[model samples]
Target: MPASTSKSPRVAVLADSDTRWKWGALTAHRLVPGGRLDGHLLRGRATPTPRQLGEVDEAGVRPDSVTEVTAAEFLATMARERYDVVVLALVGGGVQAMLHGLTHAWRGRERRPVVVTGYVGVVYEKVTDGLLLRHGADLVLANSRRDAERFRAVYEGVGVDASAVVEVALPFLGGAPYRPADPYTVVFAAQPSVPAGRADRAYLLERLVRHARRHPDREVLLKLRSRPGEHTTHVEELPYQKLVRGLRPPANFRLVYGHMGEVLDRADLLVTVSSTAALEALHRGVPTAVLTDLGVREALGNHHFVGSGCLVSWDQIDAGRVPVADPRWTQRNGVAPGDAYGTAFDAARGRIAALLGGAGPGVIAPYYDARTAPGYVPGLLARYHLGVDGVPLAGAPRADRPSGPVRQVVRRAARGAYRHGVQRVAPVVRRLGEL
Candidate 1:
């Protein structure tokens, strides 16, 4: 904790139940040990699994500190306690809870100190107003500096007054075990496809399997980490391992579960089709190939590892291998290029404290959508009129028009040829020996 003259400020950390609490909470503790940091687990759609519940129950938060609260309860807790700071380190879907807390403030008697913090990517900038700025977000924190800069650019471009955002890096384990030298290992962490990233995954995985077939002796290992509640719509429809089973690669495939860190520890080459796991592998001195280029080239730019190889496409995988020991494999310590995994919560707390001159913490009330009353479609639509809620909405748009006749014909021919090629290689994927 920073040396304080008076009693340390009490900080309440909002943690989501779906994620691991240790990393976020531990980091908060490093910032404030006696600061009354509490973890509030955001309830998910399903009942918490045994492991999920166990992780929460085992966090050892004091009875007063540990509470399973809904989005409504979060603002109530803030109002009742009027905490000095609220650190929000929630998962992808928990932003609503933060909005609820803000709504509570909007409706209630007091404002709560709050920091809006999370790992949400640029995709969320649409639904959230001013990316939580207009709703009392004072400071925004992200996972990397790059993301922070991106957030700032996007936020300011739309007139958000960017001074409120800060990017604090997660403490990545750099000296963690390195891959064993020699006998280069191709490593990839399999994510059950999600509709959002599935097309890229299928395209990249197909190309990877095709490449591996040419060098049957090369050792490649694909690992999948499964925990309950980690749902993907596509995975719910078609599980990943089933697809892996379909890819019966010859001599170079091993499927394993759990112990991902251990598995990556021995990998000399790491490949990710835009998975954050690539970052983890990179930290382990494994050369990372960020496969961000697919059909959606214009929508998303290539993700380049700083000082490393250019963002690679599936066709370039073979020629793109770089040595893990090269200087390009090294990255700066602390935050890379994104906003804090926990942005609004930390900002709310820190900025509120700043605004209040370290007096009573600023209070952030709850924000709610009337349930009994019909969903406020008009009220929601009004936000679009004001120009905040619909930012990210434009990123992924619907293309209703069918492909032009010529393009459709070309696509059909390409699909036929691609299917023929895949059929020719389908037998190859079916055997560990053929690869």
Candidate 2:
């Protein structure tokens, strides 16, 4: 690859959802003025559905410009084109796929794009050794100092050099100023399929309804991550609307969706069970309540909010209590919204520029090996062959072609089975259980 004649660096953001696209967009928007930024909607390993693409478009990302790429295509594109930097804005197995493909493409090559990896949310626990080992990134951007430290510790524990990890402030926090809504509104942000296995969806909604009934004048909004019938990265654990249909919700109760900034702006209070939105709400000075009725610590991961003074239980919400946020906690979390675009942002920009300017460090050897490790092969196949909807890389075996159609068929069959169980089998099962 030859050096670019243009003054600005060329960047490609590989994203699979609206959340990731937002993160990538922020990275692109903050680049030193005239850098070329292109956003791609990844298909395999963690591709976005059409509905997700629509939502991303609605959020102001140019849909026409956002190309859809599979793992093979991504690798092929990276190999064929010369990009100054390539940012990975994927989550879960998608990250593994991208890392594997990129590493495979750049193996034995002299020139390669600076691979950047980061999280779209706050890091609560130890950075997974598996993720770092498989990352294959030239740099890893941490959302906060705490996360950066965690990354360093994890890297060191895994015997990998941790110097590439850099701390950066949350970009989503730099949005519009907070404006409190009238009528004392409360928004219950719901997360149905958290990794910790907290299955209190019904209980949470019931609690919210009870809260709304107790105070008829105050508006209560059920802010869902994804509405019913909408495709999201997470599995549809519970259809919340169905649970509340028989509860006779108050006139003030409503389901809402929009930008987090807009939702929080209209919210006087936010209640949830371990959601990143809680951090966003706190950053805006909106009172928040972290529910603990189910008493599952690991599942909810709300323990991070303990010292924040925002922890509460259903008992407290029923008692009409709103938890106050601890200022020290906000500062410690690096989510202090009052920073006014501090030095962290500038530092991140400078780091990216330096990498583009050829001052960046070399790719760690462990990540290079991790891509081809036996444990990573399944994930690579899932993402590149079975998950994506694009052409396979040239010279790749026929067996490497994606089985997207088969996966879709299986998903549809599962959904159909679920509907049948609820409509036809549940009644009989309940009757037999009563006997």
Count residue pairs with overlapping backbones in model 2.
3
Writing each residue's lDDT as its tens digit, candidate 1 over 1-435 gives 222223666666666533334345644553444576667754433222345444333444332356554454555565556555556665433444355434444454444454545452223224344344223345555545555666677666655466656655443333354646555677766654332244455665666677677657677776664442343211232335545557777677666554445667678767665445566665555666766555323233223343455355555667645634233233332223223233423543455546546443344322223442125422442332211131212322222333357854664465455544433454455555746
Error of 1 at 68 (Å): 4.2
Cα-based lDDT for every prediction:
0.48, 0.66
lDDT of 2 by residue, 159-199 (tens): 76787787776666644555666798999887646532223
Candidate 2, TM-score vs. the true structure?
0.81
Q: Which model scores highest in TM-score? A: 2
Q: What's the distance in Å from true for residue 237, model 2?
A: 2.2
Residue-level lDDT for 143 in candidate 2: 72
Q: Which portions of model 2 show Cα errors greater than 4 Å? A: 1-7, 31-34, 44-46, 49-64, 107-110, 195-199, 359-364, 368-435
**What is the TM-score (0 to 1) of candidate 1?**
0.61
